[model samples]
Target: MHRDIVYASPTAGGEQRDLRLDLQIPRTKGPKPLVVYITGGGFMTANKAGNLDERTYVAEQGYAVASIEYRTTTTGSTYKDGVADVKSAIRYLRAHSAELGIDTAKVAVWGQSAGGYLAAMAGATSGTDRFEQGDNLDQSSDVQAVVDQFGVHDLAKVADDFDPETKATYMAPGSFINAYVFGPNSARTVVTDHAANRAANPATYLNRSSAPVALLHGDNDHIISPSQSLILLDALTRKRVEGTRYVVKGADHGDLPFLPDPEAGRKWTTQKVMGTITRFLDRELRS
Candidate 1:
């Protein structure tokens, strides 16, 4: 089913900033699992329509996909707001589970770069209880698994060790992370604030209860660095959580060549990683 896109309700402030959501389902008669896909644009550039092709590919594999639009990292929207939007989108999906024709419990999340980080946050953290401004704390919007591609794990960790060259490349207004997580309020020192950054970084929340994770990073990534994945992998190990990490050789951040060979990249991304995610969801959600 190639369904049209829909928008959820606005935030608490009455901004018309609705979350864009789309559904893609295969032609199969029986129901299938759902995958909520978030895009990577440092929280500013991409939208639900922007990544329809990839969503279609996943849907063709007999899974339903929900693509969401979060507040941009540059449009004065705080990082917390973006996270809230994703959580709300999942709530919307669960609320409409019958109409969407998919198992609400079987949903997983997948994203690249900044979006990946958000996906991880969605997986690790529970839905809003108080910290989030517009969160519906009562909603059960948690995800079952996560696929993080070159996403940041520890914002404070990366901020402290950002190479000078990387800093120059990300010459926004404040520090790269400041601009990323805080937007123009980069000077707010949220990166160093244990309460703030701790809530934002997925690494800080990993524990025995965390969903299984699949982390893919390019060994040559200059953006978030391959070490980002290593950090999360280490955390997962420390917590005794099931997880997998794949370091693609020679690939830069978001570049295809840096992945294993093209064929392997396709297989690893769509088949191997997807399979692992599907199996994990089966175990966690279906079991």
Candidate 2:
């Protein structure tokens, strides 16, 4: 594990932050395919190190994997800020690909939850200006594929579901995500601002040039609706973006462990889920 490699310095609130990422590179030589795993924090608090196990799993599959850092809403950052940091990380890896022994042309972004949204956006809005932040503008931030693990693609739609706690009886914000993705209370006003919502939405930027996408959402994922991935799928279908969605039957967010069932004692492992993602990446990257 190569630790604390600085990727960018972005100003958060009134202060500048030196963002970093850690990489796990396989022993096999020569321009390996790269996969950047963005950690899920609900756009509040989490670190790159949180996804170390997954990063190592990916590296063992013969891909260079990195656990990247991105600013959260608590730091006065928006979805754009997080995505920008994501793009910068990609560009940074590409810019120094030779030193890292990675194939810049075969990059992929994979993330869970909020990180998954960033991954989808990074792949969908490649040439467009969804976000063009940080350093290394010369190198393309385009990824060959996207593996979105239960991500929320449409913030506006989500906001409408639970802005005033109309959907549930309990404290919704703690369980159900309020649209704090772009800004505080932005989701509540999202219906009024079509342009802002469209700009912030990943589905709005899909085109034929968009990379192939793989969406993995658990059917029981209540935090971010399972339909969220389906909505993105609908846009991708219309735009003719090659994509696939694996709706897991029984699972929840951050349920990282593979829980074995009673009889077989081998039921709940995320191995099948991980395999689905890797298979898609291999086909997309042509690795």
Clashing pairs in 1: 43-73, 251-258
Candidate achieving the largest lDDT: 2
Model 1 over residues 25-110: C-alpha lDDT tens digits? 77778767888888777555655664455567667767888777787654666667766777777777777777768877667888
**Stretches of model 1 off by over 4 angstroms after superposition:** 1-4, 12-14, 127-138, 159-162, 168-173, 190-195, 255-287
Worst 10 residues of 2 by lDDT: 257-266
Error of 1 at 36 (Å): 0.2
Q: Against the unseen true structure, what C-alpha lDDT does each candidate score?
A: 0.68, 0.76
| Candidate 1 residue-wise lDDT at 271 | 61
Model 2 TM = 0.87
lDDT of 2 by residue, 179-270 (tens): 34446544344445567667778888887667889998776655666788898999899999988888878765552321122321122236
Q: State every prediction's TM-score relative to the real structure.
A: 0.81, 0.87
In terms of lDDT, the poorest run of 10 residues in model 1 is 255-264
